[model samples]
Target: MKKLGLILSFAAALLFIACKTNPFTGKQTLALVSNSQIFPMSFQQYNQFLSENKVVKGTAEADMVKRVGQRIAIAAEKYLNANGYQGYLEGYQWDYNLVQDDQVNAWCMPGGKIVVYTGLLPVAQTEAGIAAVMGHEVAHALANHGQQRMSAGMLQQIGAVAGNVIIDDPRTLNAFNQAYGIGTTVGVMLPFSRGHETEADQIGLYLMAIAGYNPDEAANLWLRMKANSGGQEPPEFLSTHPATDSRIANIRKMAPAAKAEAAKFGVTSFK
Candidate 1:
């Protein structure tokens, strides 16, 4: 009981100090690690990855990646600045690269380091499609999802420690180990992961719209992504991302709002 009490108090205090609002979602999120702590590490890892991978340069495809990434970055800045969050992106050393890989994937690191694999280009199929993917990845960075996930992971670990300390009986404790694994994964972690993906989708659509790409393309992009996957996936409740149909529907509904957001920035027409 004493250990449980201490754990609860520690978690509450940590949550108080580590919470901050995400400008895009306007919701509080954990941020135990600061940009100062994460960016250098992120840069180092990015450089190491580039050294190991075949980073394409001076090619039209590579140029397209850089161009779309820059436009998305500008759109993000515009939205943040107009929303009274100026200077929110300080210390961001934005870098974009295209790598010659067969995986259809893209990602943005904590301090704006972005990598798009060559395999993704076929699915993107156009500049607008590229914007959709880039915008989503950039949104993950801008919203500080990486930091929040780290914070959540720490909390989850703390909870496990508390569980082990509280359950004194070996047989009872073994049962708890089994239950805790399933409970946390299904009840907490999977849902949390899915929520982040949906938020990224919404924020990405807005960014794409503000960058002069039609946000409606986002839904179609996801449709292509689904077709690429051949309908094989874990159940939505057990998965870390929302199901394809749910995401497509959400994107379609958000398109009008995203376009309206772009209109506020004098971007009334989209490509």
Candidate 2:
């Protein structure tokens, strides 16, 4: 009982104090770790990764990546400022790089370090397409998805430990552990990850539109991605990402609204 009380109390304290407001969604999000701690580490790892990888430079494709990233960053700042959250990106040292890798992947670290793989270029195909991809990546950073993931993971681990402490019987404890793993993973963690993906997609669509890239291109880019995948994907519930068709459909549905929002910023034309 004492151990359980301590665990619950700790969790309650975290729930109260270890949260930050998401600027985009205006929702309280777990922030067990602060960006002040996450950023320097992310920046260091980014520099290390760049040192070991072939970072493309002085190329048209590389330039396009940087250009699109800058536009997305600016769009994010504009949105935050207009929503009365100015200076939210003060410590963000935005950097974008194209790496010579054949993986169709891109990511943005906590403090705006971004990488786009060369393999993604074929799928992207145009500046608007790149904007679609970069905008999504940048949204991940702007929304602090990484921090949320880490904080949720910490809570998951704490739950597991609390279970171990409270369950005395060996066989029953073992069963509890197995059931807890599957239940938490499928019912909680996977859904949480999928939600982040969807949120990033929506935020990216608006950012791309505001940056003068056709929000409709986001849907088009996903169509190409779907083709590139050749229909090989796990069940949507079992996967970390939304199914391709569903994602494309969602983007299509959101495109018009994204464009309307962009119009508020005097972005009447899209590339």
lDDT of each structure? 0.93, 0.93
The lDDT, on a scale of 0 to 1, for candidate 2 is: 0.93
Residues 34-73, model 1: lDDT tens digits: 8899899999999999999999999999999999999999
Clashing pairs in 2: none
TM-score of 1: 0.98
What is the Cα-based lDDT of residue 127 in candidate 2?
94
Weakest 10 consecutive residues, lDDT, candidate 1?
Answer: 225-234
Model 2 root-mean-square deviation: 0.8
58: Cα error in model 2, Å: 0.8
Candidate 2, residues 1-271: lDDT per residue as tens digits? 8999999899889989999998888989999998899999999999999999999999999999999999999999888899999889988999999999999988999999999999999999999999999899888898999999999999999999999999999999999999999999999999999999999999999899999999999999998998898988999999889999999999999899999989999999999
